[model samples]
Target: MGLRAKKFTPEVLLSAPRRSEGIPNSDASKVLYSVSTYSFDDHAKASEIRLLDSKSQESSLVTDKNGSSEPQWLDDDTVLLLHGDEGGVTHIKVGPVQHFGDGSYIAGTIDGPVGNVKLVRIGNGTYGVALTGKVKPCGDLYNPEKAEKPVTTGREFDSLFVRHWDHYTTENRNAIFLATLYKEADKYKLSELKNALKGSKLESPIDPFGGTDNFDISTHGLVFTAKDPDLNPATHTKTNIYLSASKNFWLDIAKGLPEFFEVPISNFEGASTSPVWDKTGTSIAFLSMKTDGYESDKNQLFVIPDYVTPGWVIHHFPGGSSGQGTWDRSPQSIAWGGNDTLYLTAEAKGRMNLFTAAARPTGLNPVPSQLVKGGYITSVKVLNSGDIFLTSTSLIESSLYSTVPADHAKRTLSGQSYYTLPVDESPYDPKSSQLITKYVSSSTHCGGMFGIYGHQVSEISWPGAADDTDIHAFVIKPSNFKEGKTYPLAYLIHGGPQGAWGDSWSTRWNPVLFAEQGYVVITPNPTGSTGYGQKFVDAIQNQWGGLPYEDLVLGFDYIQKNLPYVDTDHAVALGASYGGYMMNWIQGHDLGRKFKALVTHDGVFSMTSQLASEELYFPFHDLGGTLWNNSESWSKWDPSRFAGNWATPHLIVHSELDYRLTMNEGLSAFNVLQTKGVHSKLLYFPDENHWVLKPENSLKWHEVVFDWINEHAGLEKYTVWRAGNVKKQPEDS
Candidate 1:
């Protein structure tokens, strides 16, 4: 029988193999990683830790029973993972990396559910296990089963962060815990867990999306970051780093709780994160932003060398002062290549490129050299052999592994490497010492899925509507695209207002998914969108409906005039968060007449009502000030003011848990559209947040959105294409 052809659908996207960063072992001989894919039969995501042989690029599943995650290399051959049991209890499992299922043992247990656990080496060959878990007020590990049940469900808060991203604040905050880890009689055992931040009123691994990146440990001690307890979380973004030195250089005995010392940050303030310690633990390097309230400020690399010694100096790279930086791009991820070298993954133009810089430079202007160009480098690891292991993604590929030879003698410095920025505004720039390696393609991924349906991705730039500065955008053409055939345009605006459309893979707002539906997808990185520079990102402030909206207009006009293959007349626009707000803005503006339909997900209907939204810093910084003081600016950009002009068929998707924007925004927009007799539909999800993440809900979202756009664009409703046959897929299906 002929092999059944696979088409890229929401189901395919939801089930596509998702891989974690490929982490190299001590010798660089093998790589350990995790892969997760949505299982339709199980109605949940199925994950497995896999060990990859670096030489042959062959990977074997280490464990899949009960779906394991967070794979770490305990040594050159031993693997550590958080595997779940049949009863859904997470266990710290250890096994030989080479052996699949034999000689594995349940190492130990934590007091509560563990998140982000890692083994750190001490001075005397001893390893200390550090993890983040919740603790009670009495300095004991928090156990939900033993806690007293409350009679009332009511919550009272005197602070601004009443509700973060999705959940309400509780008494138990995420804290770092440290314990001695060792093997006895071939069985791993953990000592009594001690609260690393015992007396601190701050939460390490600051909420919403914090993880292992927030803290790091080495032989010297532990270095972690936590929000300042004195500052208001709603309006401030200051997360200071704290260090706790191990007893006698390496704490071996179960002694007193370690004392925490606030790492003096000098003048730099803002969101300090990704505190990473080198293998020797002699220094700690992290990324920091200079501004107080601005979350999208350029991240300047800071290094604290000899942090354990007295009067340790803090070195801020590229830009030493607040809001002053010659390096325009922000480092998204940072890793130590060697003791003196630092590897960074930063956004350049549209792609996340790998770069190498001096870890501790004496020169005033230390420029970083760009390593590999193009694609998004999600994770980077420097092996003991100095080989660089990387995991990247692109518009076409979901996951890719590549290794760059760190040896200068191995390969010639030709077109592969060069300094990213100019030196002294000179005409000539020297090449880097390293060479790029070919990508290690995924062996398990089906070629038919991406090769047959992957969109042709390219970046296009045009003069901005507000200014002559070139504004960039990503254009994705359907794989089945033809030269003569014109396709409907799917204009996608990103959220963040501080975010950009980069060459990266995303489960949500995927360009490939949109283009697969026979549409030309265009995602614009307008003013306020990051990666362009801090100035460009700051341009959107106080001009939410002003410059950004004009930039979109210019972007639309550019396509309509140049790209004859895109049917701009039947185009549809979609966005979430700030993008959602733009959709509402577009609905009430002249741009509304161009699009056949519009989609706004968790958008702001009225600027005045946005005060009710959480994260006061966001609206406070972007809208100029509070509603009371910035009334004129708020009313000027408010989408609700122009609600009478709404006429385009629209879809409003809002969730009950979206505290960032709240459900009222979508509800108010829908009410306005309905009151004006505009063709509109509201897709409400009580279980969802700002974004749709659940597998089943995502599929339903795609179906409803496709139906709405297809109906308005005079196209047929979406249908599943099987082998040589067109199968009708109902709304439920």
Candidate 2:
């Protein structure tokens, strides 16, 4: 029956850091670094930040109540901190260089009217601070506590501008120079900050034909990282480097921009990130790739001398790729322990650990210094005493650990180094794991919501349940959920008809906001979800709307019968991309009368039209072959095949720049719903691409979705949770 729900055993979910880099070093053999974790509380919540000491094993928390991140150490005792709140605040805080337990930390606020501050140290004790805020007349310092007039009003700061300032140069004074946005405006305007920070400002000379990629500033000069799209074997897939500096201090001798260095193609590739220069500023060390970007491998160390002429020479260490092809062995948190020694935090065989490399431009001799099993090494930093501090996390909590060099052997710090930073570790279910388990579990609700979190079900056993066809489902219950009370359920379908729902934080398609709004949100990976092995993924090769439709129906049936607390009659089916395809499919197929409304986000309706369009060629490739070759299969599964039967009220959402699915898909779906006289609405974002990434746009998106749900389902009333204008609903014609 309906492909027997394909018995699938889900694989273990692998979690790793998305971004990691060593912080700017304050002194010789002393460097600070930071790491981030997906928040268990809310997806919108800012990542946790901790300060690590490399010399004397110790770590400390840097963020406060609202959330702190992007920490840049200004000096040994002072750090520039940025808080991720509605009004992003940037200021300098004076704190202890080394972390001590007992919850004792001394921090002094540096008063300024800057809204979002991005700080970069240009020279010794001299820093560049970028200020962005709403324009208003300069009056009393725009302190949150004592501002009489609206200081940040008028046009908001959409640009980033850099100004030279010094932290240790003045005890309590901050000397800020507001610069003009390059080319856009002249005469020392403060708004020009954004343009100067773009990759184009620090242009790359490596491939004059290669467009600007990414760039950063270092002590030696500005390093611009780029990729050549036309290169053989896809150049710069993982390794990245900087061009050599020129004789003139203002220009780089490596070619391209006068102020930037171009990285040689031979030395760069394989997902390279976080490039830093040595204390001597004569050589640069960066994470090098041993395999393709998608492969799970520990990035090896690659060194290049800054003085190498014409082209830079690359060196790989012996046994350097020891952990290659393994997810748990990637090296992170790299810093210079000394001019000759490089320290890094790594994970191997599912254990978080540390390693040291005595490097030379010719070759690297790496040695395994420490092994931290059973926990994750999130960050590492070196101290003046040659001690190493690290921030670590387990499933239960995050803590700080320290180690010091003793008799030439590194040892954990005694009672003096370990510090337990205060963190809200309230148990929030891991949505990714739940989803995985549910997909593999045998239950009668073959596809219904079963887990405690999105797309995961803990118990798949249902009354009178038989056969392995039962698909388990997971739903994220609201934070302050009541035991027996019913809540509106939002049935979410993931894109990639091939993609499965898992427990991970998505900056886009955030389900936490719905849970926070007192709604039960459900996501079912269905068949063809990745991470469950190759067979399951291959199941949906050309069966997009066939067996998958039945799985969803069975899931709905199970949820309605078992989850009485989930107002099944008031549920809304929502999805984007491929998920949107399912929504239209369900509407046309008349799968169930349970859902009161639906939302289709940039989904394909007419597969025939989509295949003919030039915009959808890549997606066609991902689906196995072109529609021309599989015309019968494509037509059979096309949502437009059953469009004439669609009667469910729906809301269509899409972005103008979404070339993948294109706005035409949403527009066509909306037009069909309107012609059929079905109750429907449309929301179009002009500036956003496939996903709404802007902060303001994200807020508006949430507001609009909630408003649409409330209008049709009679859910909770809307209210502004944070400061910002709430977007008004477009008038229904």
Candidate 3:
């Protein structure tokens, strides 16, 4: 008989506070980060900014304002904050105060047309990137729905990607504009902004993945930008380098004359992105991929000290690997260190580890020196004295960490203020040693999700494939879990097959929500996962399904055998993209019988269709070659081939505008289930893209998913109902 609705609900669980992101000050003296607060029920929630004072290790709220993001520190005294102000509009604000007292002051009110803003010191004057929207005006920065837009065609779409991811494309061009910053008696104001990229068709700073690294400023205040090579707005995404010597350099161009002072850099054989000037500003360092049309190509770190010459005097760092010995599936962000060295974080062994290399060419191969070997580190900075400040995250906790060259001990200056990093507490008496007495307490953001605590997070490792290589997985248990209590399994497989379920908390697929429903969640990073080493990541190619599937199966078996609390009979498998493909594959594998149900979100159901995807390189590289030459490899792993035998009830979610996988994949999978007459449901989001992002939609998604799992896989109470029947779950022998 069908059971009544239970006490568990998505209301409280979805409200769980999660860490939004972390940003470090230029001086490494303070850290600014945003965390989710559930004090309000709005799914379109904004994060509160909190500052961590490194010296005092004291944490204080900067902006209690509901959803701030992109926290950037201009200096020890100034910080730049961009966040949703009113009606889901992004507002940029920079202030003289270090800590948010009266709260965050919006800087764009006088700066310029608010767009994507970044602040860089240009000589004695301050400069920023914003949209003036004068030529093509950005009429609003607060509410897109009510945005007083300029009347043109008013036609929403003159093209593709009019609706990107979750929201419709705004008229804003995200151009780089100059904010006239001046000081009046100890007081300052940023106003009189104008478009700087005059006579340019390129988007300012380049997007959709561009960060602050997308553009850089020289000591002389000149700006260097890597713009996507597309001039006519093509589907293919690749970037090219451009530079402006000074503000007046573009004055002639802005007047519609080709007399612009700026010029395009050397056109390379491939895409060049993330340009940064050296300390001396003599040369620049950027990551270049030799092959065009492919985003996954291994990067070659190139230094162009002679940018003014006819072509870049390209110098390749011979020793280190692409992405600077790190696997950057996207454009790699690199930082400059003392002695002209570059420090980067690479995906290695399921961790985002730190590595460093010099800018100048070395005679031998550049094998980067691995520094911070554990946890996930991003936004690395090097001091003149060789000190490093970065943000690190693990399965359970995340915070800003500092390392001095002397001892290299990670001083947890933020989050958990552990002067003594985990597992390395000193033996000396706490009273005798200069020890920090208190830890950064979990924020109000933590202990959220209807005030229900998250699972006890930990890690596990298992062997894989023919080599029996070690694979890592982040495992979670229901809050206040007891060893004797068996719980349903929520096997959450991550995408990127290149990405790992690392120590840091995730907002999208948080294990805490599953734990709140009394389910044990296991996020596995199989053969293709990053931070494992280049060889491991490279192994996923050609053998996509062959090896990674073996790793997943064996890892699941290991977890089931080891963790008796997992009710395997009532388990449900869920994944997105690559993980989704794995879930589809699982439908045909013997593992299909182990799970009560499955969920594939925007998964790759057919390689044939994916080859024609908006992105061409990922499929071209991962499948070894083009489909014509490697038909066998493509067919061997295509999840669609196994759909004929699918028996388990499944939920297929595909966004209509998911150009990456396209909507056909999910539709095809759902069609097969319908044809086979198996129990299934299909969720189509016409507004969303590859991921569900709209707050209300995301909330509904969580509710529906949990309700489905409740009926199909026994979320909390082990009431498994499969294939339209309440399957008798096998009890402990």
- TM-score per candidate, in order? 0.92, 0.50, 0.76
Ordered by TM-score, highest first, the candidates read 1, 3, 2
What is candidate 2's lDDT per residue for 1-733, written digit by digit as tens? Answer: 1121111101001011222334534442333444543332254434445554544525456553444545566566555554433433343333443542223232323343443343444443344344433222232123444435557644433321111111011111211122211111211112212222132322222221221122333444444343333332111143345443444322221223343344553533454544555655566666655434322223555666654352564544434233332222346556666566666666432234555655553333333344333335555556555544454433222232333242122322111221221122222222322111001111111221111222222223222122243344446766557888998888888887656554333445755446655677776666655533333444676777866777787777777887887888788888888898889999998673568888888788888666433234233433445677867777778888788888888989988766556678888999999999998989899877667765556655666776677566667544432223222321121
Error of 1 at 555 (Å): 1.0
lDDT of 3 by residue, 519-564 (tens): 8888888887765655676688887778888887898799779988
Instruction: Tell me the RMSD of model 3 versus the true structure.
Output: 7.7
Error of 3 at 6 (Å): 19
Give candidate 1's error at residue 518 in angstroms: 0.6
Residue 613: error of model 2 in Å? 8.8
What's every prediction's RMSD, in angstroms?
Answer: 4.8, 15.0, 7.7
Go through the candidates in order and give the clash count of each. Answer: 0, 46, 21
Candidate no. 2 TM-score: 0.50
As a whole number from 0 to 100, the lDDT of residue 537 in candidate 2 is 46
lDDT of 1 by residue, 16-59 (tens): 67888887787667878888889765798877888888667577
Candidate 2: Cα lDDT at 188: 13
